[model samples]
Target chain A: MAESYRRSRWSNALFVAPYLVVFFALLVFPLFWGMWLSLNKVDLFGGGQFIGLRNYARVLSDPVFHQAVRNTVVFVAVSVPTLVGLGLFLALALNKTTRGSSFLRGLYFSSSILSVTIVTLIWRIVFIPNDGLMALIFNVLGLEPIGFLSTKGWSLFSVGVATVWWCIGLPMMLLLAALQQIPADLYEAAALDNAGKWRVLTRITLPSIKPTIMLVAVIQIVMQFQLFGQALIMTNGGPAGSSRPIVMYIYETAFIRWDVGMGAAASELLFVIILCAAMFQYWISSRKEVA
Target chain B: MADRSAFSPENLTANRTLFWIAAVLAALMLAPVLWILGLSLKNNQDLMHGTDAVFRAPYTLKNYADILVNSQVFGWFLNSLIVATGQTLGVLTLCSLAGYAFARLEFPFRRAIFIIVLFGLAVPEQAVIIARHQMFNWVGLHNTHIALMLPGMSSAFGVFLMTQFFNAIPKEIDEAAMLDNTSQFRIFWKVLLPLTLPAQATLGIFTFLLAWNDYWWPLISATKKEMYTLTIGIASTQTNFAQSEGLGFLSAQAIFASLPVVIVYIFFQRHIVTAVSGGAVK
Candidate 1:
């Protein structure tokens, strides 16, 4: 009996041992090591004395980091609503079970499957000055071409548009699934009451999928907070750093400038922001279930 | 309401209105894709003069031909394939084993470790990227496929998904296998593992897509030209931002790089959609 028990425990350890090793090495260890690195004056050459929060102070005081934060905030603010709202709109419109609906869902969702590089490449063609699709339209209208990507005013906006186009698919799919789960009987009852379409949507549809809306919103927020590639490819954080995001700032600081300590500090700040968002989601979801 | 008669006048008109709206939106969504496609077929010189030349004739496959002739593009393509497939298989094996342990086996510190894994879900890749890169660099693993594949294998999301899936299976199956004197590994491999195919498909498709599309880690870690994945390799091929000189060629590269993902999406639409929806809400 003792031998059997010991063998079973060893077998159980075998099951989880590999993942735990990777988990510690790749995830857990890196997380705390990153925190420790944030306190030091490390660079690409490695090994430096611990500076004790001076890196954080410098990163916080840097003006470029401020702009990157502002740009990231602008991105999350503008893109999250549009992604969630437009996704909900698309889901509601395509909620009906028909051949056309599924096809349209697929068409919209197809873009999300694409890599950031491909999505940005397609949008760059659309937004490039004087000869892009947008420019072609402007010419047709005899309107002067605006530098969607080059100009500071429109650069982040252009990135937002491309991001929405790329990311709207996931929210749409999630909302559509939530909409499908709303029982048909609830809709039938609302119909029997002679409820107006808007009334039904306002009363029944929105409330049923509230949790999903929150989920999608928080997901987009966390995702948009880490905006690197879109800016990297689309605007390259150009036009006086107007479109640079925090993640890009981290990349530039660490990889480009070789300030690993400051980059780690900036990234830790980003991690805090994401943690807050995740915690907010947890609070909302758990409280929602209770209520 | 679902009860509304299919042929009712009110319903038909509403449906028509919805259809037209959907059609317009679909066109808007597809316009960028189609625009790129048109540009990809046109001559680079013509595109530079005016983007409207896409509508004219004399379209050529020279752009695609150029890409095919570049030996580096093929190398990048192969690298991306190896990394994505390797990562996906590694994630499946590790997650399923750990998930089986978490869901079924009674192990010490299981609850605590699982909580730690769950906490990992909140930790963005950006947060730990520098440290992870430094670790890999220290070990002289940077610019290698192992460097590309190893970090992705430590996916908390995969472990979580697999655990939930394994948990959903009835305990009776394991008990029945135990009655047959089957080893726990045998049960997991021979009996229980087969039942999780649907979950495996969902997780596998997602893992593959993410690994394939991943950029940040690859960009920094795989710095060597020979080590470049498709994304970094293609991006490297660009000589300038908003490159007008090789517009056709750039478009072709974008299309070519995305072709495999698009093909995978076409084959696994159901699984992809399920993973997207279920992965989030759950």
Candidate 2:
């Protein structure tokens, strides 16, 4: 019996071994390796030498990194709240609808599945000056065409627009599921109190979905914070560096400029920001729960 | 929730308004895709014209034919297929094993190992890309489809999602299997595995979508054109052809490129909605 038990234990370890090897080698090791690289000046040819916190300091002082950070903030600021609000609105709308909502749910969620390349390219075609879809619509309405992707003022907003369109699907689905999970009695109780739709939405629906709202909020912040391929493909952070996000900056630094130390530092900075945002959301969600 | 009363006038009005709003939102979401499809169906000459002229005469499938006949899109499609399918199968298989171990088994340092894996949740792939590239290069896997699939294969999210799922499967089932002198592995494969089909489908669709839509990592890893997935290959080809072949062919290629995943999405969207929300609520 003891021998069989020992053998079973070994067999279980066999099941876990491959994943452990990868978990350590890929996820854990590379993370620490990246950290180590950040503290050293690594060349493609030459071996690294420790340069301490200079890379972090340099990233702090760099204008491009500063711009990237601000751009990321702008993106999150624009997209995150919109995503949460729009997701909740659509979820409620869908949840309330008496007809054909399941089909509409699929329609709303379709764009979220598209590749960044497809999404960006579609938006690019949509936003082209005179010959684009928006331009055609403008022409029909007797309005001047807007240069969404080309101009400085509208560029980030344009990316934000594409992003919101592409992303709202998942959040909407998540929020809708959350909405469906709320017991019908609670809403009925609210209605019996002579509550209006707005009142029920605030007092019952919002409070019921508070956790899901936080989940969607955190997901959006982390995702929007790492805005890369959109800016890379759509605008190339263009017009005036208004849309180049920190992740793109990290990509440029590590790959484009081949500055491994700086890339690592910038990545670490982004990591810290994401971590803070996540922690903040955790605090907010947990505090409400405790109360 | 809308009032569920069958005959109330107010309820009927609310439902009508909801349906109208949904119809408009759906149109807004799908109009761009339909417009691209219209552009693809237009002749080469119509490519230069605005979306207003997209409906005019001289419609042709020549652009589609040219992209199919004259480009390496077929090869890019194959590469994407190989990677997405491979990554999905690989992630699902590996995550099931590890997740079962974490969720069901008792072993030395299980908590510690699980914590380490959980730690990966906070670390984005971008944070480790530089090191991952060097690691892959050291292993001679650079510029390969394997490299493109590798980082994504062993995701902490997969492990976390699967473990949560496995934890939900009642231990009574496993214990009953054990009474028949059945092995743990057998229970995992034959009994519990069959029960977790919905979860597996969810993970499969999620992984497949992430793998299919993945752009940045492939862009970095697959330097050789033949190695490029559909997105990177199309992006590269779009530049070369945009100035020479005009936007019609590019539109055709983009439409062709997105079709398979889009089709899969339409088919499996139910699994996707439930699974994503599974993570959100539970």
Candidate 3:
């Protein structure tokens, strides 16, 4: 009996071991190894010698790294709010259980289903000066077609626009799920008080779903921080590399330039920036809740 | 006053306004996709003429045919299918096992290990991507679909998701199975696993979509042309076509690349939404 009992307990370890092997090797191992690599001058093809903090120092001084960091921040700042805010507003409008609510939800969510390749490709076609969708609209209005992808100033912003369109669905669906969870009685009570729509939204809807809103916002920031393929495919981080995100910079650094240490350091820098954003969000949201 | 409640003039106007708002928003959202479809149907001569020329005459699917005949679109599609399916299956099995163990079994240092997995959740791929690439290359898995499938197969999110689901199953079921002299494996496989289909579906859809739509990791790992997944393949095709194949070629390729996920989304829309929102709330 005792032997069989011991066997079962050990068997439980067997079940988890397969996952842990991969987990340790790919995730935990890489995590620490990357940290170590960040400190040294890593030679991908050969041996590496430790040169503490130099890679981080280089990242701080590199103009392209600075540009990538700035560009990533700009993307997260603009795109995160647009996606989260637009999703929340749309979710509110669509949560009323009207006939079109479900259909409209799917409509808004369709673009999100597309792969990044498809999303970028579609926008690439649309952003073409005289032959794209915007062009069609511009031609109708008898206006000059904007060089959406061609111009240096407009490139990053255009990438953000495409991202916003692709991303709104996830947050919208999340906020909608939270909305569904809100007790209908609260709304009935607000209605009994003859509260207007704005009052109901502020006092009832927003407050009730505040946690979810924060969740959506935090996740949005985290996801947006890792932006790579969009600008890579759409702009190739171009028009003077204005749209180059930090991840793209890291990719080019590590793989293209084969500067593993410098790339790892930049990766660590991006990780810290994302962590700071998440922490900042929590701090602000918690303070707001208390207030 | 009772009669005033149902069809008040104010409510009627608000309803009309809401309808217009929803209609315009829907149009804005769907217009780009429809415009892309229209653009994809236009031939190169039509595309170069102007935006208006597309609507007038000369539709052609020669671009689509040219791509299908000329390039490895189907090969990329098949590769994407293989990796996405393989990764999803591997992740589902591994995560469910680990999740069940954590949720059901009493073990040493389980909490510590689970915390590490949570850290994995917080750590984005960009954080560890360089080392991951190096490690994979060191293991001789570079330029292979296995490399793409391997890193994603052991996801923290998947483990967490499955753990939550396993925790929700009544402990009495496990106890009853134990009382019946069943081993832990049997209890897990027979008693608990069958009950977590909803969680499995959600996680499966989420994983499949993620693996299919993955761009960056695949872009690096699958450097060889034949090994490229749909994303890397289509991205290259888009640029290559920019100079050679024209706007219609790019649009057609975009549509073709989009077809699989779009079909999956239309069918399993609820599952996708639930998985995302569920993961978010946690």
Candidate 4:
């Protein structure tokens, strides 16, 4: 029996070998390398000095880093709630309907499949000044055409709007699935109790889908903090760096500025922030589970 | 108590209003896509002018012709196809093995390792891109397809999904296979993998779309024009073709770039929907 157990153990090792190799090589190795690179003054073509927290100290003093932090905070503060709230609202609306609901759900969720690049490009056109869709709409309303993408104040907001439109689909689909899982009889009971739509949703539906909602919120927060593609493709974090996200700043520092050390330092900072957020999520989720 | 009876005027009005509202919202969701299709067929002059001539604009195949003829668009398309397909296959093989192990194996430090793997899901590729470039350079794999495929082959999301699915499978099946003297690897190959089609399909579609649409890594790593993927190619076109007043052709190129994924989506939307919804559940 012990020999058979040993054989099974060997088999388990063999089964897991391929995955562990790839995982270590691709994910784990680069992560450690990033941590090490963050410490040193590394160059693009090779050769580096061991700076030892100098890069980190420089990042702390940089005004651009501060701006990136502010922008990221603003982005998360505005975008995450909007995305989850809008998604939930749409899911609720669609859940009540019986006719063509499946088709509508598919239509609503389809945009989630489009890449960030395509979404940003399409919206860049839509948000263009003077001759774009927003211009056409304002002209119809007899208002002056707003420079949505080019203006300083409107740039981040415009990007946020486009992001909200693009990202609402997945959360919407997830909420819809969760809503579907709640039994029909619960709603029927709520109706029998003379509860209004609002009450039923608050008392019955909300509590039932609390876990899913929390999961969606956590995922959205993580994703929003990593917002880079839209800023890169659409605005290039322009209009005097008003829309520059932390990730974009990291990319610019490394690639455009050729300051690999500074970029690595910034990446490490971003990594810490993301790690804290993830830990917070884990803590909250586990606490809930235990409760 | 509210009456459950039908045929009430208020109920009828509410139903009709809700239906129309939902229908309008659905149409609004599709408006951007329709607008893109409209722009693709128009001339550069028509596109800039923002005239209602979008529909009445002389429909020409010149844009499509140019994309097909003038640029290295086809080469980029082929590059994206090869990379995406290769990455999909790699992720399937690797993630499934790892996922099955995580689900079924009773190894020492199993939970600890699984937690470490979960941590990977939170590590965005963009964060470590500089280091990834450094490592690739060191290994002499920079600018190669292997550079593209390597990072994608180890997907946290794929492992997460597959593990969730694998965990749902009964353990008796593995034991039954063992009693018949089948190897563990063979059991995974012949028994578990067949049941994993839905999960595999989900990961396959997602990985394909991701690798196909990846811009940053390709933009940085693939300095050569010949090595450009679809996203990089479109971006280069938008930047380089800025002077030619060739919005129509550019839009057409964008359309062409997005077409393969769009067609695949349309054909396999049911599978995609199931997968996405299934993913949400887990």
Q: True interface contacts reproduced by each model, as a fraction?
A: 0.59, 0.50, 0.56, 0.36
User: B1-282, model 3: which lDDT tens digit per residue?
Assistant: 345443331231124456468769888877778887877788876667565666766688887787778658889888999999999999999999999998887566778878888777777888878889888888889888789899998679899989999999988777777777887888889989999998899999999999999888898889999999988888876655434247776777778788888889889887887787665432
Q: What is the DockQ score, from 0 to 1, of model 2?
A: 0.49
RMSD of each: 2.6, 3.0, 3.4, 3.3
Error of 1 at A44 (Å): 1.3
Give the per-residue lDDT of model 1 (tens digit) for B48-158. 787788999989999999888898998999999999999999999999999999898876777888998999888899888999999998899999998999999887988
Estimated TM-score per prediction? 0.95, 0.93, 0.93, 0.92
TM-score of predicted structure 3: 0.93
Q: Is the docking of candidate 3 incorrect, acceptable, medium or high quality?
A: medium
Candidate 2's docking class is medium
The reply for model 3, stretches above 4 Å from the true place, is A1-8, A280-291, B1-16, B240-245, B279-282
Which candidate number would show the highest lDDT if scored against the true structure?
A: 1
Residue A206 of model 2 has an lDDT of 82
CAPRI verdict (incorrect, acceptable, medium, high) for model 4:
acceptable
Write candidate 2's Cα lDDT for A1-291 as tens digits.
Answer: 323433335557777788888888888889899999999897664378999999999999999888988888888998999999888777766765444777787788888888888887787777777777888888889999887877887989999989998898988888876776777677666666777767776787788878878878987898889898888888889877888889999998888888888888889888888888777767876775785
The candidate, 2 or 3, that scores higher on lDDT is 3
RMSD of 2: 3.0
What's the residue-level lDDT of A184 in candidate 2?
Answer: 68
Error of 2 at B74 (Å): 1.0
Model 1, docking class: medium
Which of candidates 2 and 4 is the stronger one according to TM-score?
A: 2
Q: Looking at model 1, how many pairs of residues clash? A: 0
